[model samples]
Target: MNDLHQKELLLKSILENTRAQTQAIEDDELELLETLITRREGIIRQVDKLDQEMARTTPGTSKEPTGPIKELLRQIITIDDANQELMEKSVQDMGKEVEAVKEELRTIRERRRQGESYVPEYGDYREEGVFFDTRE
Candidate 1:
């Protein structure tokens, strides 16, 4: 296969894998998601290099790719968009959870402060003197 075709295939594969990884976010598989994100970043770098190579090889007038390559490019764009949305939603959800935790902490602190100031109705008593007897 030609280099362009190979690059297209690789890009499509990476995009597909990234889409799959985004699904893992819903499952709460954080470790796997982190690994996948790292892999996706590496693949994105590869895609960028390939894009640069294609740009260098192609004529300036023919700015757009044609045929199967074009179609694959469109698919990659759609998948990437979906993955971006998913990631954004995940971040928003995490932000909400963090806010909830902060509010809960604030409530706990307020209650602790209130408790500290509270005093029972009964008065406190103190011993004023101590005596020791040596007779047996």
Candidate 2:
């Protein structure tokens, strides 16, 4: 197989994995997402290895990507951008939740502090104990 064709196949595989990753993200399938990302990484490593071999064989030659490869890369980059945006939104939502929890805790502490500030009437304890008998 031609090296370019091999690279194309690898890139297509990466792109397919990337699409699956997007679906995993949307569905909140964390385990599947992790697996997809790992697979993509392995595919990417293969692509890099292929490129290195090609470079070694064709020294000093500019190996600009052909049209279809360029298009695949473009799509991959665009989807990756969307994925980044989704993750950022998730982070922001979680941040808001954390702040709300902190606020609730602060309110509870303040209410508790106020409730603790009251002193019981001194007369209340007097009934529980007998004064020295004034009358025989």
Candidate 3:
């Protein structure tokens, strides 16, 4: 009876540990997502600034003349477009990571549901004891 109690306690401890680790990983992932969103927002603001600058510097075919500001504006626009594309790809990758994590969580839940019995779920382990190759 004591052995059974100890086994149960051990399983409970393992489950608790797993839950804690999962929670920590989830928190970290959330923080990373927030950071990504913040970065995207910053990029958007930069794009808006570029737009305003361009509008001020090149409203029409001004009789005066375009300066280095026009060239700089063009370069800024290119940079903004590239940054936007890169951020979009990063977001897509993050989404894939989220899905992978979710799948891992699902698998962990299933394994937990199966219980921590020493008996193997396949092969001749049900009757042949440890001599059986459970992997088969």
Q: Which candidate number would show the highest lDDT if scored against the true structure?
A: 2
Off by over 4 Å in 2: 28-32, 58-61, 118-136
Task: List, residue by residue over 19-99, the lDDT tens digit for candidate 1.
Answer: 777678768788988888788788878877877877788757365778877887787778778777887988899999999
The CA lDDT at 62 in model 2 is 65
Error of 2 at 84 (Å): 1.4
- Residues 1-136, candidate 2: write the lDDT tens digits: 9888999999999889888888888887889989999899999999999999999988886688878989999999999899888878867888999999999999999998887678564534645666687896
Name the weakest run of 10 consecutive residues (lDDT summed) in model 1.
118-127
Computed on alpha carbons, the lDDT of every model, listed in order, comes to 0.79, 0.87, 0.53
**Model 3 score (lDDT):** 0.53
Put the candidates in lDDT order, highest first: 2, 1, 3
> What number of clashing residue pairs does each candidate have, in the order they appear?
0, 0, 0
Better of 1 and 2 by lDDT: 2
Clashes of 3: 0
Question: Which scores greater on lDDT, model 1 or model 3?
Answer: 1
Off by over 4 Å in 3: 1-65, 116-136
Predictions: Cα RMSD each: 4.9, 3.6, 25.4
